[model samples]
Target: MVYPPYLQRSWQRSHNLTNAQQEALEMAVSEAERMTHILQNLLDLTRASHSMMPLQSESLILNDVVADIAEMTKKFEHRVIHLEVAPFPVRVKVDRNQLMQALSHLIGNAVKYSNADELVSLQLTQADSWAVIQVSDKGDGIPLCDQSRIFEPLYRVDPFGARSTGEAGLGLSIVKHLVESMGGKVII
Candidate 1:
């Protein structure tokens, strides 16, 4: 993701610079943040794949957790996320922190891949005794042929770096690791 250049105060504060200079500085800062994000995701992917950290699983109210996640999505993503919950509450056993990270990653991915006018939603329901949370978006989807391998670390649909972000392609892998660590499955 191209994170905002929040760290560069001079670019935001200085008014004396020429228009060309401002644009150039903003571009440079954005590029640097994107690169840094790639590197950080790479490190996180490695840690997720290699580490055998004990999962601190616990029972939690699924509705409450997803509600907090919805708020977080709106705040950080600056997008309105539609959320739906079953009439009855559902409880789930999961590692709270990992579940949050994985769901956030998936929801963020939806936002990243979709247009502002498109719909992005989180649907929560109880299937039998299981609590299910589905993150969906009306974005261009992965080719069916490549969908099977998306959870593999470093796998990218755009292998030729055709995508604008030049991402390291570790996002889904990290999400997979986090989810599976708590005995949860990712259906996408």
Candidate 2:
């Protein structure tokens, strides 16, 4: 009786994986990571919606935040992020991590929906006593009918697109909650 199935004489163990097999393995890993990200977003949504975590608000410069966001995005997605910020320091009190996540989601959403050649821009400007942050992209926009509901939790404009991107549609909802938590609003 063979104690271990791998010790069978007819069984051959090849140390090398074929190119297709290797690619499949890589794809599987990518999918797994994507799923993990989705789960984390879900947790974030729950926490934000329920106020389980309080805002860790602090004074921050918008220019530095935009610069860091652009640099960080470059590592994850191959896209040009055009940043426009006020020459003067635009300071705001907010949770840095949440703000970064919100901006990153906007930029990532823009990149996902737009053509590779299309432009994506993140702009920060001081308007009156308020600091305005906007993310714009040249992409096929949501239908007017769906635009009003886009920020609702799990509301996807295109389910197929969400499927490919592995987005559970909690991004905009989280953005809304986080921004509101810091006494701000998102205007699209």
Candidate 3:
């Protein structure tokens, strides 16, 4: 789904559209693609959610996944997604695509909410028995009051705003559910 650059520029320049209008237009074309992605995620989550997803449990390199996400994020063009991987490779046991989906969701959100030039950082580290993957962004961070409920389904932080990112609000919920099902925890 391609949004014509001219339309985006015109929308961006229009005072009548407001920020929300611009966001809505950008999101409209992306909605189908995002929903497709969410559906695929839901399928993966269904397997993992029900403990039916098979875990390969091989020594997997974290750097590879981070690299893959960084490369994939390049398509966004409007955002600058960065990776701050540890100097050493961190190995873990997990399903590669599922993990990638989880990280992709994080990176996706970072890109969605952030301004074009903002930085989104993906960090990987190992501590004790757990391997940690953190994706942080410089966008208006989740509001203090809503932090607790951000993982709830259909929850939108800016539901009525024109600049709002159009999410079914299921991504993080699915991420949380899938992670816990996989014996890993998700932190916002």
Q: Total clashing residue pairs per candidate?
A: 0, 0, 2
lDDT score for residue 185 of model 1: 77
Where model 2 places Cα greater than 4 Å from the true spot, the runs are 1-24
Q: Each prediction's Cα RMSD?
A: 3.6, 6.4, 7.3
Q: Candidate 3, TM-score vs. the true structure?
A: 0.72
For model 2, give the 10-residue run with minimal summed lDDT.
1-10
Better of 1 and 2 by lDDT: 2
Whole-model lDDT per candidate:
0.82, 0.83, 0.73
Clashing pairs in 2: none
* lDDT, candidate 3, at 96: 75
In candidate 1, stretches whose alpha carbon ends up further than 4 angstroms from where it belongs are: 1-19, 159-163
Best by lDDT: 2
Model 3: per-residue lDDT, tens digit, 1-188? 43457655765666777788778766665765666655765675566667776665556888887887887898755566677787888887777766777777778888888877778888888888788888888889899999999887667788774234545676777677666755789886
Error of 3 at 155 (Å): 1.6
What would the per-residue lDDT of candidate 2 be over residues 61-164, giving only the tens digit for each residue? 98999889987877778788888889999999888998998887888888988998877888889889999988888898889999899999999999777768
Q: Candidate 1 residues 1-188, lDDT tens each?
A: 34455636656675877898788777777778778877887877777777655678898888999999999989888888999998877888888887888888899889988997787899999887667899999988899999999998778888876247557678899899887777777887
Cα deviation of 71 in candidate 1 (Å)? 1.7
Candidate 1 collision pairs: none
Weakest 10 consecutive residues of candidate 3 by summed lDDT: 161-170
